[model samples]
Target: MSADILNSLARRVGDGVAAVRPAAAMADSEATDPVEAVATALLGYVSEPGDGVLGRLVGALGASGMATALLEGRSGRDIAGQAVTGLGPADAPSGREVTAGLARWGPRLEEDAFARSIAQAARVGARLLLPGDGDWPEGLDDLGVHAPLSLWVRGRPSALAERPSLALVGARAATGYGEHVAVEAAAGLVDRGLAVVSGGAYGIDGTAHRAALAAAGTTVAFLAGGVDRFYPAGHEGLLGRIVETGAVVSELACGAAPTRWRFLQRNRLIAAASDATVVLEAGMRSGSLNTAGHAAALGRPLGAVPGPVTSPASAGCHRLLREFDAVCVTDAAQMAELVASVGGGVGGSGDGDDDAMTGAPPPRRLEMLSSAERRVLDALGTRRSRPIGDLVRDTGLTPGAVMGALGALDATGLAARSGEGWVRRPPDEASVRPGSWS
Candidate 1:
């Protein structure tokens, strides 16, 4: 772990006690002295300095606006505290100055207990990422003071900078329409080469991840808890696949369990990291609404998939469209188009740009298949999978046409049957490499 990571861990520990207790665990402890409780907690880590490191650190941070500087690993600098405070501009440091500062502080912090705590977390599958690392999403910087000093990633490291990323958030106790919308939006985002980002909670978030993975598109699960202890425990397998293909990210250090406060904090990262954020379905009081709010606050383009007006699960999205002015997206093409209109445009994956469907060669072989077969296979490209019925409906073809497509899909190794008669196939590897198919 780096010094920036160590400082971030310390900050998260301090903030945890300062914030409201998690909703799931606040049983009649409201009468306790909040400051005393926090101080007592601090004692368990730092040796009792008269003024206390936490207090001094907070003061120093306030004076120098040291949060961003800390992320930059510029701790040893003696800049005027007034000038450094609150996202202020500064003289660019020479390469030598940066190198010297890191060289001095790196080893000292490495042996510190706080650093060890973060390291322990990493040992058990957690990852620590600062602003410049591969796992760091530049969008988080938009959070300003609320931005995490370092993100503690539980699952996939590749998710940090993965392109074509969009956030899918909604209520955990989602309605069937909400669930269906979540799956559709997620799969559509993947088909366009974007990764789906969401909190690894039960309802909409889980659906998004599952759909993205099923489509062979990347999906990122941003957790509020330590990576070692997957929250909702039921989604452990889902988290596993995300780590394999995308990533799970956080701001807390290792061993930091999930709490309600962390969930809100985690929301900011999801909002800021993506080029755009989509609320597939959410209730008026849904936690997903928090993410949507954060995205809008950051000036990130926000979208919602409309649902039945009767669904409480979709009320939040309706509110966004009605009150918050969120874009209404009906399909993947619009979602991708909206995301591209903002900054998180998808297509290239450090390999090559996504093929433009407009001028591509006419598919003679594909044309041989019935319309439904062609439609099903069309959706089964290099990223994700789709259900036969989804294809049937999406293509406006009959069930027989869908079935014929499935048969050709299996024969071509372009798709394979999976659970509940759904079929999935990743993009063909040969198409990605030169002359492989020939």
Candidate 2:
């Protein structure tokens, strides 16, 4: 961990707040964009300890884009301050005002809502990962102005940098095809020992996490809101499993809901934090495009899964392929290989690298079952227990088909019917244990 980097970030962030102190104070009173207010406050503070540094620094920032400069070895402090000054008196704070405000509200900025947000994140299981932390992915700093001040993380923090991570994002209203691709890709990525990262929204995100969990592989979900609040509501169970097996992460603190701005900002985090960003099924105007754009802007590897041309949900993906130069991926193996080789960095390899995504041996001659049998197995594999009607609906098979499947499964001792529901039998349970179904 580089203490210097953390210290620099803390100072830079603190400075940005100081630059916009007046606006922040106004926003506090008026209830406006406090986040922007804080960003503006820091304009004058990142300058070197001198009177004219702010003005000079502001000019340089405007000319060269100071955020990018900072990532490229320019000092964050000098660049931030000078850049604010270049905009002249109309745009930037005078040194006197900056100095005076520094004295009066300097302490207040430290106790501002932004600081409290970081504290709130800390109160949860999340750790505040600042730049220079061992867990900080150096690649993320490439985002420049959009780079996160700190990351709120749960689970193996080291995985942020230690593992090869791929972001799988798609529409919340994903189709069966999208969900299937997400699951297969996630499972494959996990089997290859890559940490799967996604938005943890619903549809594709939920399916991705569940598949990773099913494979017993590490997965992380980056949320736009908070770790405590699972958006879309449907994926609460899936989110719980992710927290238990891998991690649930966010840049925001607890109690923050997923707002439109936050959702857009959230895309930046997903892009900056991962080794590659893969779009599974995005609509024509899908928000996932924002993430893909961010990844491309940052020069990160970007992959998109091609879907049926007729599917509106896949429109954004095809657009990315046609307009944004994103690589088209069909499966996890291709995704992993493209991500590893695309960006001039070797993708991570470890214990699960050679593991099969199915986590089971390939179905052999005897293991191959009839369509009905396979349907029953698929249902059982997806959900441990289900009523006959549920199985019928899930498999889209007739009641007769379902019954026959269940009968064969029961005879083979692979499944059992109980008063509560039909369930996949435990491998070693000679007979149904009392209350086992219950």
Candidate 3:
């Protein structure tokens, strides 16, 4: 019964089925409310990346609450009320924006999307990384409302922060000179204890990833689509190799196709996941500039390599250096200096400051579960049942708190009344991995 509610709602509209509450409890619900993980994943599936309205809504209501609210056909104004109640109106979406957001998400919210997503991911051995997980890349917290809610990683989660990472980005039609420079920079950054990060596109991105792998260094490739498909079709073998040594990551769920907007949004992730971003080579309107912009906005160090004035392939890099105040870097040492200049903080995990523009909280600020919920859920088991008294004794929580959590969990399909006491749901029941992995 972990994600059963979301599945059951495939045809249902709204009935206030799941209890709506704050999210801090859900964040603390690592093992307790298996559906909480599914709920969060469902939110991502229903909405587009960088949707500030949905992002803040999830932050206020908790993913479970927000998911329930959406599934129940709540109005945007009504849902926005949660933010007004919890985090205040600073970042709450306008009723109109929230309405538009719901309209955008409505069609995408499919039945059993979470179940099928996790199943496919499991087949590929990909794991889901929640915002507050041990393996989560904290640097992405800098994006505020625009950050990815969860990361689908197809390889080593450790690759994200094996050390501070540097994003080497540029045009796909990279020149020989640009490829040579990317290779040198990637290998050198690897030797200097920095992981290499790039979108798994051809030319510069592929070149850098290959160089880092060839040098036996950790590298991470951020994809616009699901990690399951490994976009660009031609890079299948390359991505597979990364799965063996590093990681291939995405924000999209398994089986979701990539779009142009997703690719652009994916650039922000590339910039956010690393300590610094460098445009090895790009044309005048190269997409790497998008990555550089995100790095600059995030306060991550930005660098651009110089090239011959006559080479149109180098136009974007020169423009970045000239217009965006990006640093001029020609060699790997210079690029390493970009990472060094910023104290080597990956993903810009700065102090707890709300975003100036969007008013989004620091990373994972949107995901929270009450302490009582945490204790109660922690005490429940999927197969074995525990009575109220046993739970109070095991968790040291008051009977009232335990009972309240159980009620909330039961309402959300996290826990259920067994023959005697209580037991967790089907998320982790009889499955090799937790329901959230889906």
Candidate 4:
């Protein structure tokens, strides 16, 4: 990557952040340093969010120090050598680990990609937030090395820091019962003068966000990909409305696309950014459980809104109440009290429940399925048949893994062969109305 090009783009983005949220509007923090912005932006471009090797390097060496090392084409072994001194042996990534990370990050280091990313953010009027920026949320710092290198924000940058935030997340295939609860809860929380945070997906997340907006309350949407491109294209209008008042935030560079792993990684941010997390409705395998897992891991208060025990969609919430000691919350008042009334939560992400909200173990009903099988099931179509290749591509699974997952799914009656492809079979309960969850 050309440092000159990176620096130029960073300067442009810096100016754009200033234009959108002037210095007067910034919190009483030091002025954003152009040099640090360039370095942070470079790290964002070279590595995916939550990259452990790069995260530790940046933590030890600072963004500029790490970026300079990578820009100079220093070998990962050499870079690891430098990081070990600062991080100490206990925390530093090994040479092999750093080299592997390099392999994952190296191909995306093109200057043109960086330029496009900068242009996209500018086009979207996003402000850049470095670690010490006044508007940068302190809660994110809890993640240590896993915290975001920088954040891209659209809408009022101050919205992130304006008030305490609560994360309300659940399944994209949310039940009407779930939506009703989410709307009521979100509206109540906002009315009580708290900011709401949720991934901007369909179903429960969208319901909570819309309810908060209708209440004329502050809310934040944490995205898995670039804030510039709203995933689940159907939510573009909702996301746009969010940017009209509350902020839309992302750690990934502007050109990055959402993926399964990234979606899982993104859950950590939503959990970290909020004071508490509430699961409105989730199935045994709902991604919202993953978010609850993150919240539990951070010792943030966790709550689960109960649905009928008969409803499979509520199984994860019940699991939380029964297994993880997540506070049983029915209304907004109870949800808010989860943060105020409770101290912390224990245990999360047991087996494999991954993103839409994101962690817990697979429900007992599907406990036999491996994580790979779960991923394949996530990528499969409910009615439409998909060939093994499509599943492989969508889930980022190797062909062999996809085949194995398909085999497991078939035996479990969760999927079936159809015209040389596969379709999800309806379980004992009704199949959910499909939408983007991960």
Candidate 5:
């Protein structure tokens, strides 16, 4: 369990794996570094996802170097010091943060436990995916320092990079409406040649996975626990099927149990691994919102299905729509549109401006404008300038509201002032510009 023992075991595992399967190393250029794989696997066993200190250390020193440093009993700050020596000053971890991180990870560095986990993973047909692996999802790079140290993947590792993916998440206690929407959305996404990603919990996540499978599409499940022990044992069959057709993935090593914090962390991988996130149905306090938040923070497009306003089960979706600038997507086509907009860096608002980027005429730009802005534009004549007071009277809005709306329009070149009043810009000039207003 000591550092020396861990180092020795790591070397043995690395050498054995390399010697036994030279083809594996040859097949995957990135996997040639068996020692880095050993270290990364061990790190997955000890550190939690989004460990900025570990991420920074690995980024600066490389996974092999950082693993060697940790195996050599280097303190967190010591590792940090070495990692930051030649790097430009940025937001890298400070000595204090590294010290604290070391304290946190120190107790979890049981070499015996990690070795056993690695063996268990191998027995279960899981492989360790490092940063440079060809199968690694490039979308995750957007996470920067918070990206996973390494991923434990079961099934086809290439599935992770097979196509652009979308995250379909919702309440575990999902209503039939939610499940139906999730299934359709997932299937439609697959038909469009994109992969579906989810946490693999019950309700919406499970439904999405099943639907994707039913449609014979690739779908990946990110687990909070280890891939060896699927959570919600009810979905064992589903997980197995996914292992056959897609992949079951995790940041934790085998034998690790799912925890509340790990579940939250797992949501980030779901968000980051996908091009967009869709919330079918969630309550006011649903965990799906956590995933949605991660998607928004990562600047990924987000979509939410609307439900009966009277249904409390739809409260979270409504909240996301109302407060989080989530696109109101009802059917698969709308969801596809959202995914299509993702390449434009459209983050979740789903305002439809991105359509213009694909050589399509931009939809009415006013649809995404604020009500006040829309009202002001409506009140102003295209060819005639109207004063603020006139706009307020015509729109039945306050003078301040009129001025604010005019200011927004002017900023976007949708409105221009003539003499002492404002006029609506030409339709051609007012057409939506991708990534401009959003």
Candidate 6:
């Protein structure tokens, strides 16, 4: 497992730290070696979250060696060659992919940026957590190569590592019903002694964090940008409270800004860090669905609150329930049940086999369609035909998105073209049919 690389990296980090600060003084105050901390902080500056190439390289060469190779401007093919010798043949990256990844990373490398990140973290009293740190969330290890290189944390790191966690995510433009459900779910989970986790966005995410705090429960906010600069500027006060009472965490360094791609990538962390994920309310295109998808892919249980059928804000949740096999969760009790089922047991439930004890049904269908595809299916009539333009209006999707969804649905035999337009397919013969369609 590359023990030599890790041992060498540890010594280098310790030596580098000793050179900068008195070994005896730092030994008493810091939890991590200074060099390892600096190297990882620099890696965050240059690499994006979920960079499989960087993750594999670090796994093979250790963080210190990888940092040195990059700093020396070694070619990507050279790095890949070294990694291949350490990793199994099938697990290694292609030279072309590594080269392209290196090109993407090259422009972002700057020693000044790395130094600024470290200094700012120190000024803000943030701790740097590496793979083996006591406070690291082990659930993140489930991500394999996509796991974070390191974590920059504020507040109690125990908030993440010490308790079972659940992710509550939804639309940034959440409605009143959505906010109410989020608050109730968050408070209820806290009462059950679970830590609530979410991205620090407005609407549902903010509501959940606020509810957890109000209940005097632990909560953690995973950010897309640097922990030093909170996004959605309006949440500064709320984030300050989080830092004081819980934790605000980020994979990015102190100076990094939030971007669309980063936010999408950040959802996986929210899912991986939690025992389960709940979507309280969301549009068909809401980013929260992305979190649910990650949870499902990771084999984590997923739950969604059912909202009014007429409400666009709840479309994503409905889609998850119907197509993704997301458990139907209404209140805190149901939410707790979802976690209990996945966590083996909760409270005093014996032997973690509550489902068998309680005779609950096993989870169905382990996969689902994307939100866009489901929305198109939802728009079609069981017996009548609808044109693409009509579907676009009914689903509030663009013509291109609707057409794309229709094409996919048709390919999958879930919908088919008819003389008039398109119609939902008959139920498969092997499956039970419902009494009636609404």
- Model 4 earns a TM-score of 0.79
lDDT of residue 311 for candidate 3: 98
Q: Per lDDT, what order, best first?
A: 4, 6, 5, 3, 2, 1
Local distance difference test, candidate 5:
0.73
Error of 6 at 393 (Å): 40
Tell me the tens digit of each residue's lDDT in model 3 across 328-399: 987877787888787774342222111132211111110233545644665577899898877764444446
TM-score of each: 0.57, 0.56, 0.73, 0.79, 0.74, 0.74
Model 1 segments more than 4 A misplaced = 1-116, 348-438
lDDT by residue (tens digit), candidate 5, 262-351:
666788888888888888998876778778888888788899999999999998889888888999998776776777785623223322
- Report, for every candidate in turn, its global Cα lDDT versus the true structure: 0.58, 0.59, 0.73, 0.77, 0.73, 0.74
Clashing pairs in 5: 301-348, 302-348
RMSD of 6: 12.6
Please identify which of the two predictions, 2 or 3, would achieve the higher TM-score against the true structure.
3
Best by lDDT: 4
* Candidate 6 Cα outliers beyond 4 Å, as residue runs: 1-32, 348-438
Q: How many residue pairs clash in each candidate?
A: 11, 19, 10, 9, 2, 1
Which consecutive 10 residues in model 5 have the weakest lDDT in total? 353-362
Q: How many pairs of residues collide in model 5? A: 2
Score residue 330 of candidate 4 by CA lDDT: 85
Q: By how many angstroms RMSD does model 5 differ from the true structure?
A: 18.6
User: In model 5, where do residues sit more than 4 Å from their true spots?
Assistant: 1-7, 15-22, 25-28, 344-438
Model 3 weakest lDDT span, ten residues long: 358-367
**lDDT tens string, model 6, 223-307?**
9888888877999999999999899999987777675446667888998899888889988767787788888888889999999
